[model samples]
Target: MTRPARRIARTAAAGAAVLLALSACSSQGSSAPEASGSSPSSRKLSGTVTVFAAASLKESFTALGRQFERQHPGTRVTFSFGGSDTLAASITAGAPADVFAAASTRTMALVTDREDAAGTPVTFVRNQLEIATLPGNPHKVSSLKDLTRSGLKVVLCDRTVPCGAAAREALDTAGLTLTPASYEQDVKSALTKVELKEADAAVVYRTDVKAAGDKVEGVEFPESATAVNDYPIALLKDAPHTAAAKAFIELVRSPRGLKVLSEAGFLAP
Candidate 1:
């Protein structure tokens, strides 16, 4: 071959080698994320997630909220804990909340029926009624009928609240008629009466009694089996932080969330 032709052939081969090297580097750069198990398109959650939950969920939900915040940097979780009925009413009244966790299906319906829930609520846990009394059995209240004894002060949650409704159901199952000293708006309030020694006993949730630790004593009645309440959670239709709210709900339904709730004395659904 001629020297000029040989020089041209060598130059062409060098240029092709350079092009191939550049192409290999570009391919490796594009696949680096996949190789490292990282997602380039995954969204970074930020802002606050406002959760309106039943008072009974305070302990478990608070722990779950902290876990969520840690998993998602720059995100915050704030909670509004109250009676399911009241929280449902607030959600229906256009109260700004990212999520709602109710203690009963009936209360959850109040929000679902009004189209305030973004989707069908999921029942994550169940709770049963228990008689909460003073640290010791000062009244010897061993059974549901014991609360009916004359002069024994007892408190009950209002009929509108899930705990109140469950208490009534338990009473009906036992075929007993006993009036309470006062009807409180929530289970926590009723439990508070017993904790303060103002009432001899109060019909509240097993979870609440457990949460109270030694502050109160819990008595399980057989009738409570018939009055177990299912707890449901949902994302709000008008959630300001839609993505973050959904993520938080996912965490609540996850196994880790269930573990936290189970530790808090809540039964799995």
Candidate 2:
């Protein structure tokens, strides 16, 4: 081979190697995370959030949970819906929950007092008690006094739960004392009695009656204003998924969250 030809070939090979190296460097830099200017907090999150919410929140919270999962793919939301007092007890007893959403401030105090809550509790919504009777008002039940009618099988929540306490407050405000055929441990259970026709009526949250659809009828009483329960939510100190828990709380306090709860008949706090 001639010297001139060899020199030309060597120069061309060097130029090609330099170009390939420069291209590889540019590709590596582009592949690094944060290239899009997204902060850690704004990045997509994935994990499981276990929420302990009140029985009255089952319908609304379930919807919010599904929305949260959709907004943050690869995330799971597991809920334990029941009496607020019962849920507070579970959290105080060290249950593995990321968030606690109670139907009343009293129940939330139980967690906050024990330092189980990560921060100060915030009131998200308020709920009022209502008389749930058979659909179509078959018995003509209309007011709080109607619940005291003789031969009416009425059910009330156990006094330990928020709904029960609210019912008692409403009854006291109306100056009426009536006996219930059964005392249910939770609002859902009390509502179930009327839904199943086992009881003629039940004093439960307005949201419960709304959730029952056409299965039960709701009667509004003026006394309900005196016994409105404030719902408070907080993050747990020992949350297994802290970031996911925070995100879930933010979603619950967001405008979309309030819209879902309001549509279910819950009053704004």
Candidate 3:
């Protein structure tokens, strides 16, 4: 089935459960979310579901995992979140994972091609590049071109990652080029360079900046239109826990999952 159809199906399957959680949270106080990466269930479902996710999805996915646990009591979800390339490499190496959620399809293709994916992958969300800089107009960095300022110390994702590919397209679209002082392996690392004031700015997802929450400010640039990237998730063919993994993927595509991801700044697939 196509990704949109998979999403619709997953939503239909998981929406009611998530909506119940939302309703419960609304009426009662929220308990601390489950340990970092676990599914939620009413009967304390006991099983280990490992997830390989992109570094960019850290905050949002972590929250989702917690909610999953709150909903399904005993399901333990372990996650390895980092650069898509790095995570893909691990899965290819026989890392026992139930689910794979990548920042880009190119990386997911690596696993799927090797018959590592359980089935055809689905695009769950879309993200675009945004420039992150110090709060306020301190540097007067207003556009993509502004990132080329003489004193600016910019950081970018290594070319192997999806964000870097998008950044390349954005720069090419603007008819301007920049020399980043460093190329980090993932968007979070690039954002970290800026957060620590090690670099003057970075190009990353709007959600990354949102995750930072006051740590850094995001500036959307028009050229980002040409550089939008898609996020794809799938169940691993060799997953130790396929049934659980499929359920988690369903949650992500479900209306409840979409609401969470959308609130975190991801565009719906």
Clashing pairs in 1: none
lDDT for each residue of candidate 3 in 1-269, tens digit (9 for 90 to 100): 99999999999879888998889987665444434346433224568789999998988788888877676666877889899989999999998888989988899999988898887999999998899997664787889999998988999999899888889989999999899999999999999998898988999999899988888988989999898889999988887866567677878888999999999999988
Query: What are the models' TM-scores?
Result: 0.85, 0.85, 0.82
Candidates 1 and 3, the one with greater TM-score: 1
Give a tens-digit lDDT track for model 2, residues 1-269: 89999999999999999999999999999877555765323567888999999999999999999999999898999999998889899999989999999989998998999999998999999999889999997989889999899999999999999999999988999899989999998999999999899999999999999999999999989999999999999989999988888889888998999999999999988
For each candidate, how many residue pairs have backbone atoms clashing (under 3 Å)? 0, 0, 12
lDDT for 217 in candidate 3 is 89
* Tens-place lDDT digits, model 1, residues 56-167: 9999999999998899899999999999999999999999999999999999999999999998999999998889999987888999999999999999999999999999
Worst 10 residues of 2 by lDDT: 33-42
**Model 1 misplaced stretches (Cα beyond 4 Å):** 1-42
